[model samples]
Target chain A: MTFVLGIDGGGTSCRAALATADGAILGRAKAGAANIRSDLTGARTNIVEAARQAFLAAGEDPDLIPQTPAVLGLAGANVGTYKQQLEAILPFSRSSVETDAEIALEGAVGSGDGAMAILGTGTAYMVRKNGKSRPIGGWGFQVGDQGSGARIGRDLLEQTLLAYDGVREPSPLTAEMMGVFRNNPQDVVEFTTNAKPGDFGGFAPKVFDYAAKGDAVATWIVDKAVADVEASLGVLGLEAGDPLCLLGGLAPLYAPRLSERHRALLKTPLDDALGGAVRMAVRMFAAPVEAAR
Target chain B: MTFVLGIDGGGTSCRAALATADGAILGRAKAGAANIRSDLTGARTNIVEAARQAFLAAGEDPDLIPQTPAVLGLAGANVGTYKQQLEAILPFSRSSVETDAEIALEGAVGSGDGAMAILGTGTAYMVRKNGKSRPIGGWGFQVGDQGSGARIGRDLLEQTLLAYDGVREPSPLTAEMMGVFRNNPQDVVEFTTNAKPGDFGGFAPKVFDYAAKGDAVATWIVDKAVADVEASLGVLGLEAGDPLCLLGGLAPLYAPRLSERHRALLKTPLDDALGGAVRMAVRMFAAPVEAAR
Candidate 1:
């Protein structure tokens, strides 16, 4: 009757699930941000709190979180010693920490070999082949995230400044951006100075919308985004028929724009990342290792 | 017996010079950062401190800063209400706040109509024509500063990640960056997360060095930087023989790369920014404005 716990934590929120050892979900709950790299102690607290809430919702004592073996998919797990540092402080009977992208790939392609790209505010890729996992390009906004919504939005701002400088001809997209900023490049600069990746990602929709209408600047930006994504896919060694799923907030928008060759690899995800975490938890703690999908 | 003061303040340090009414520098001094936008109170403190030191060095009473009129070229003066705000809070009997680029332009072209670009960790342009000054692309690191050392280093990081992912072929520049980061993209990501523009700009010399040796990636990056700079110059409406000066830490590296048209316009600056400020201070407060040349 052992129950497994699965937690998915990100920069904004932490979610948890209580499920049977064989992977039947019983209850769910959520808590605050659990970005270990940014806030290790706080992330530990949030992870435990979310697990406690999930247990309570499952009609079990919250104190049982300490007895439950758990799997977690968390943001900032791949960089530095944050993962090991986090694992050491957890109260769960057994704890395993993996990047959010790893769980998402497992969720999308289900226990089999495949690849997935999370094209949200930031971009990260996860590939599983022959039971081995590899990660690419979750480098954050300062340097990486090439085909991400944040990158696209940043490109929009860059082009807007160029048009303002008469370095590039103004298009409808740039004109609208200028209007929003009150035709003040300083205002734009100020806005971006403290903008998080999500803040910049807010403008991605406008870029995609304008590109749909043939706005020259928007089209150029979108074209670059698509090219970058396709190029990353090539680097992943994904073939035309390989199982691939585009996850994250911008996935739907980018799906159709992928080159025809890579586009054929897209498939509906079998489960979301949390579900995958629960599935992994069950296998890691209860089921025989060979029984995993 | 009238004396004037000139101050140049930036993110790194604040410099001041004391001069007679005829624009002869009597003494110079330096203090800490006086970036008015990021820290008004601190900037005010540093500005006054620098002025005090300059006056003391000039064998005058430090308290006379309250009696002297000054023209200041500051890093953050161009953004928001910082200029006016700083002007109102100063101890000086009269103080004029101007962007650093303004002083640099005056320093280079000497009281006449012309243009200057400061190509340092950041890029900014200032044009003075018929006694009116216009600024372009001082939008800061996050949104503007195209063709800057900061931007060039950022481009190198971006390309390095691509090469690591196999999306781009490795070149000497990329390989060297990878080696520096110990062949770990995560290390690169971590290094960049908290990196300032100046931090990224630290790598600019390596880029130029590699470009000089014909590294494919470095050459491509430098070409883009040059094109962006040339484009901004074109937008400034400089003629083939306009009085143009390239200033700042990276100026020497970029000078040789300018197109023949812009190269023809390059001229040695008569003085640096602090001297330009002193000249302006004398003209504005002690000497006849028309006496400036």
Candidate 2:
């Protein structure tokens, strides 16, 4: 009868779920971006809104929601200051705030002794060992998030512009990009300017699609992306035989491009970050009531 | 005395000069971009303004100026359709309009017959022989301006974003870009969105500057640009023993990086595009007045 709530707050969107102690999903909800670095109040509201939806979907009353413990995997929560800020907003008597990277790692490898590389709106490589998480990269969309969907998207846009500038020979990929942007170079500028990390990241699939059609530039971009991911795995001290997990919308697209050494290390997760959050919540609440608080 | 006017109109700026039939410069003027494809009225006004200034600088009143023949080396004027559009607005009674690529070639070789590569706002390779111009590549900024300043700038920006997204390891080059953009990821978007071909081309110098400091990403960019330029030279049928002129702002930066074979072909221009334009104007006016018109 024990209920626990798990939340994964990302840059573009947030997901929350109500689950049983055994990882059975009872209900779930999704909301807008809740990254504290960009929006603090929005982050709080998104978490609360997602939680309320999950509880309501589970046919539970609002007053009864406080009985369950919660765990939040949030972007920007790794900063100590942000962790304190989040703790002030959530109602969980037993709750833990950690980076989305850490939560993704726990979700991908239930045992918490492995590593996970996330290739979503941005990219992050995280390892959890000895009850601590170490991250190699995840600086954001400005300084060091390589091998991520956003990186791939940015590359695609750049090559397209290079082709437009006649600095790169034209390939079918250039034509496709030009067509997508209606052949107006200004549109490429406009779309990229207004794009969020996730919005640009979304173009990763299109890059793959073009590559499949024999676009050399597109293929080059994909191959480069694979190399970037492989390099990240190497930085994590991951050997050829070590266990690793790939997560995010881009993982599947890049899966076919990984090296055999890295491919052998890949493992499909039994649960996602929300499930990991639920497990964390259950463990937190199992403590004595005084210790839990 | 016969007077000749030579004009070089590019994406960011225009240069015009009045010269004697013997290639002696009398005066010169600078104005903003006069690429007709990007700006029609602006292009005409810029040329007229620059010509007027040059005439005044040479101690001639605007109305007293002779109806000198002119040669315009302009970006975007190579496209046959665009050339016609430009011809309609320019004031020259008789003029020859050619791609900046051709002008760069004429500039590099002077009155000699040879080949030249330009890595300016855009990149192109052209060969001049028997008074006719043959171009190897000048496909515009979107399809094949390899080794150009614009390509290098685009690469630098893409690498910066990749580093910021945690998809790649941070390099000193990426760090430099972050610092230049004020450490704001959003500023990257803003700067790139508003970027003109020349703006991206402008970053070529920064890439070289960073490469000199041993930044891996900058070095990679420079290496790639050199490769691309060499490839363009190869396509132009440039032999080691043949004369090849290197013109454009980026040419000097790339000189130290070229292969001996390329270095052997490289020659400093005795006269730039402006001088070549003057030469062309003089030649045109030397013909029968009816033929000149």
Candidate 3:
């Protein structure tokens, strides 16, 4: 019997699912990172490995893989001409590629119209209206991704330094953050000299934790972050009737802190990114009744 | 016949001055970057090479180097144990090392008690009062260094991305910045993935130029940057009697934009950093009358 394959490839990891044409999932598998920008060779390898694992887990004939149709929602696909290149080389009989945000929107809304904001180590905003989708942020950490966990963590570090300089009042949160770098502003400075977004993101949970405990500085940072999220949602024009889902690691932390206006429209995703890819696969390859007969 | 050496080492370049015990500069020389944090080996080599150049320029006997005292005002000397390490290996009879800001302060204020803010690719504020000195900010781009050129340029890129997303109105400056990255937010993202503070700083001049032309976004950014500078000065507690000087690459651009309160306190530098270093060298090795006899 024929089946379809769905893959969600991201910076940190890749996941694959094997499903029937009716959208019933058969098997799922996961592999290492597939960030097409930094490690194209590694990403291509991981994507195929994930698909192979999914096929094996489904207990399908190995020969059937050559004929399986696949759809991939991948990071780094939005920027370059590599999508067609990756498609041309895949083992599947047919394949299509879309951005990770598009698949996330598909999985969250399930063919419906809505918006989703991912608030993890990075940030990306997507709005799907009347079958067309537009992305707002997710430009990456340096230039965009405002109010993301990485940005929040960076802000925390900055506040810690300000407190060190006596420019700002020291708080328990800032003290603790400085303590991690040995209570030495110099060490903190050294650490940041070569820091990446994920490295900075390591402090995000502390911000949320301190905010929960009513730490004034932490509360201020969280408030600013939530305000940035609201601004993106406003730019996306989230209406009273529109559903908005928050996704990614920091989403849950930010959920309760969001304003009542957003809380009212906030939604839980119906399916995950892999499920969305599976649905996309079905859309791409589900046979007509006459063809099936 | 005795001579003194003064060296000013920074991330970009190193300068040296050879002067008499009375602090009359005899010669000056320059060398490549000498930041201790990122390039310890290079810093050591550059420091010695600069001293050699100064000595040669001054027509001093190279063989008398071991008897000639030296003072260094070096960047990256603030945070590490390298000061003692560097001192232990110098070729001079006596060598003293201080932070670059300290030298700049020495250079800017001479023997007087006062304050100065260096607003270049990074920012640092120093106040010397009654034989004591204190520093504020200059923690580096990832943490502090607010109102710095690097921070300003990064802010420009961020605003450009915001305009691209339609979250903010696009201005000519932001448009030009995006144009540099080929109008691709992804391209901008990719460029920042590996950009250093200096790379970001390269765009700061554009921000100032646009602000001069009354570009709304550029004006807003410049105003906010100047405000941050003012806040830092306030934190430094510039007294009515205190002499303040603005130094560094962006200082001239920011000098006119400063609030009247700051402009009123601002004064001209007494000398360059090398002059400060030479004065310091004289102080470090001024012979007692008994020793002189």
For this target, which candidate reaches the highest TM-score against the unseen true structure?
3
Candidate 3 chain A lDDT trough over 10 residues, lowest sum: A283-292
- lDDT minimum window of 10 residues, candidate 1 chain B: B284-293
CA-lDDT, candidates in order: 0.88, 0.76, 0.87
Question: Which is the better candidate, 1 or 2, if ranked by TM-score?
Answer: 1
Report the lDDT tens digits of candidate 2 across residue range B24-114. 7899999888878767888889988888888888887655344666788897675537777777767766667777776766777865578
Candidate 3 regions off by >4 Å?
A: A38-42, A287-293, B37-42, B287-293
lDDT of 1: 0.88
Full ranking by lDDT: 1, 3, 2
Candidate 1, superposed: residue stretches over 4 Å from native = A32-49, A60-69, A79-95, A285-293, B31-33, B38-56, B60-69, B79-95, B285-293
Reference A-B contact fraction recovered by candidate 2: 0.09
lDDT string for model 1 (A73-178, tens) is 9977877888899899999999999988877887889887889998999998888888888887777787889989899999999999989988798999999999
Candidate number 2, chain A TM-score:
0.83
Error of 3 at B185 (Å): 1.0
Specify the poorest-scoring 10-residue window by lDDT in model 1 chain A. A284-293
By DockQ rank, best first, the candidates go: 3, 1, 2
CA lDDT, candidate 1, residue A167: 79
Per-residue lDDT tens digits of candidate 2, residues A149-242?
7878877887887676555677987788889989966577667756777777878888899888878998988888777778777767666545
Q: TM-score of every model?
A: 0.90, 0.74, 0.95
